[model samples]
Target: MNKMYKVLATASILALAAMPVAANAQQLPAQAVQKGNANKQTDVKNVPATWGQITNFVHDKSDKFITVTGRGLAPTDQDEIVLAITPKTKFIDAKGKTVPLQKIIDGHKTVKAFYSPNITKSIPARGTALTLVVQDQSFSAIDGKVTEVRDGRILVKGTDVYDKHDEEIWLHFADKATIIDQNRKTIAAGDIKEGMSVRAFYGPAVAMSLPPQSGTNYVIVNTNMEDVNPGEVNELTAGTAGVITDQKDGQITVIGQPLEKGGVNYVVLSIDDKTQIVDEDGNKLTKDALKTSGHVEATYGAVMTLMYPAHTHADKIVVKKAESVKIEGTVMPSDRTSKDQVYVNVGSDDSTANDVILNISKETTIIPALGGDTALRAGTKIVAFHSPVMTKSLPGITSAEVVIVTSDKDAVQPK
Candidate 1:
């Protein structure tokens, strides 16, 4: 019996060795197992992150989600996915500062998201977002002529080299939008005017309006006007008409028609003893006759300052008499033959139907209550001075001698 037991035990041991050695029995050491387990945990923690542009936001009472584009698990995977936002999710900006989720959405910023490897088996996989890093704001530049300068916006008409097309864009100035001269010196939005060349940096998102619109980041006014050759003689015959914007201590600044065709919208005229100040009838007048908001025609010499609104000695200045008719009303929307004109509703409301079409020519003076010339657009309240002799039509058409912007309600409001 003892011999049988020994044989049986040997047989058992032989069978165990001959049979598959239950893999675990020949397993690696505890340290190796621990290392393996640690590696797996590390893998779970180090799942590859996917980056994409935030296309849209989805929010409700109990949940928040964001749609991300240009990201996928594989190279051939769909480019968009829906990411769930949890309380533990963190939002970081390019500056490494923590920001609210709304800020990223409002900025329409791109982001990199860290999420779990597990995702829904949907066309565009849905996953829980662990963290999101907001990318820096990317800016695009548009350089062109300023077609219009409204309360807090400007229309730029020029060629877009990237798009390879001519575009007119209305750029809305943000509260922090910087306006600088060619020298990088800070300037005011009012300093910008139609007909001047400018370069503006703005965001990628553009509003689909009549002329595309975008929020401007910064603007650099091209103060470098084409220099006149010394050899070329300037015909002292250049003439301009507009309203006197500034007059003090024998110096007058006029905002009106370009000194020459296709020139700047303003000019600085230096008055001296030889300068002739007169009225339309050629009656002599003192230098005091040149007043702010007074419509006038000016003739200047060829020699002028290099700066825009070129400064020069005035050979003659004709201050026209004040318009006899005065109309106070809100600027209304109407079909216009030119961008230089606006339709004014004669009363406090549009119900009056008494629309007066004010043609804004180079001679019209636009005066903002805050002190500066601005282009007139719809929704502005103004007091327009014009001649009583208007076109005999349902809506009288006349030239606007002076336009006073009484309300700045349409002005830009910072976000």
Candidate 2:
């Protein structure tokens, strides 16, 4: 099979920030400690607010001075504030139960932290945390395909998320487990079925098995086939690629890539207020933003509605990249002087063209089909989905999104 490339990134326009130096969260700077004291002008009546997803956390047992990054606590989103916790500080879970401070200090925990403002400290000084409210636990959400579902168990498969490789996990539900849909309606244990889309929030507990197993607690469902009788509905699955053809009010029409011989061209999508939309990178987007020119890949139910153009409700819609293009040839060594970079030969058997050099930064995603990028060698049949827009400088003329390695002499896209 030939290699296939699918670029996930658009033009880069990210900002730069100042390099950081570490500090203690417990024993904040003298200026911070002073301002936090009521005698030094600290006011609780008009305390500043900061709230956002907790990106990082530090728990210092030795120094007793815990120092860590602050989330958005101000009225507006603010990630610049510093927070320190002491024995006097309090921690609470979703149920308002007092959770250990040691439990709160972890990466990616959404929290609202209030700190003592008006600090007399120098630039970017750590502030004393007046009160911290944890909105969620240190739980991670798993979005994937449910391969199996039983009374108390469910099996799902998806990318590792962190490592970007296919992985499978099993979830077991407790008798009193809490499970809800997008509308906050509680779902019955029997309602969840195989081949449905699920966004499972797992953590707080899991069996220490190879792939590990946990409770089927909270979930977001895209479709439910149990709504219809057999032979009355068609089927749709996850990762199916399509393009938004029309959208009005809340109804959406998509042109799915043909799947069967003499297949239908258009699909009618029922969009509710709860249906989620996002770009290829999983960033949330609005319904109006789904353009006719923009392609999409979605996860819906197998029970397709019997409409003029088969219909179904999309659980999740990931906009397919408009900037994606195919490139095939050999892997060329990078000679440019830069941190992360790679070059590729875009020539084919028909004609050998000029080598297209690509500059790879930490932001550039290199999805390998086989061995890692370092294994890419000269004369290797390579295929990549890269951006058509060329960079203004050297190192790389164009950047890549997804790169696949072809075996032997096959340049045809592999199934």
Which candidate ranks first by TM-score, i.e. highest? 1
Q: What are the per-residue Cα lDDT tens digits for candidate 1 across 286-371?
A: 98788776778888754454333357788788889853366789887666535777778888674645778888876665655322
Q: Give candidate 2's error at residue 358 in angstroms.
A: 49
lDDT of 1 at 67: 68
Show model 1 residue runs off by greater than 4 Å: 1-234, 237-239, 245-253, 261-263, 268-270, 278-284, 288-295, 301-313, 319-329, 332-376, 383-385, 391-397, 401-415
TM-score of 2: 0.28
Candidate 2 per-residue lDDT over residues 195-311, each given as its tens digit: 777766454344445455554444556565234456544343433455554577677765544343123334567777677888777798888767653567665665553222456
Per-model lDDT: 0.62, 0.50
**Per-prediction TM-score, please?**
0.32, 0.28
How does model 2 fare in lDDT? 0.50
